[model samples]
Target: MAEFLQRVQSVVWNRKLIRTAKGHYLGLGPEKTEVGDGTDGKPVYTLVGEAYVHGKMDGEAIDFQVENQILVEKFELE
Candidate 1:
């Protein structure tokens, strides 16, 4: 455990809102691929891993989206 802890680097959150047929989800992934362009002409991305944000995990993200006018985007895990 101590040896592994020494190899740790910086901690950063690359949070993103992902929308799919099932439901909306929050994830983190810095590395991604440019799949294609969306209807709005924005570049689509693919995330790698799922993340869990403590307080924002419940319905807080939804409220924030409503307040901030977050757009629904497409993301594929790779």
Candidate 2:
């Protein structure tokens, strides 16, 4: 799963849009860094970003705010 995430990350790097099998699109938003504690009880730095989705609506693009992670989990690159 980590490998798949890495692949997806590489493909979507620099906020490039990628189309999925389900006719939806995926792209990175922006880079975000946060400080948090890790499993070792030490401060851990985390890099995070928002993933966006756009669904096709009657051949038009409709932006969707992803409230469920399952939508992204089902993405399969062909």
Candidate 1: give the clashing pairs. none
TM-score of every model versus the real structure: 0.35, 0.23
Candidate 2's residue-wise lDDT over 22-61, tens digit each?
Answer: 5455433444422221234534434355545454444343
Per-model C-alpha lDDT, please? 0.48, 0.46
Give me the displacement of residue 27 in model 2, in angstroms: 4.9
Error of 1 at 43 (Å): 2.0
lDDT of 1 by residue, 1-78 (tens): 876665443333343433332335433333331223123454554345544544467898799989999997666655
Model 2 residue 74 CA deviation in Å: 36
TM-score leader = 1
Please estimate how well model 2 matches the true structure, expressed as its whole-model Cα lDDT: 0.46
**RMSD list, candidates in order:** 9.5, 14.8
Q: Number of backbone collisions per candidate, in order?
A: 0, 0
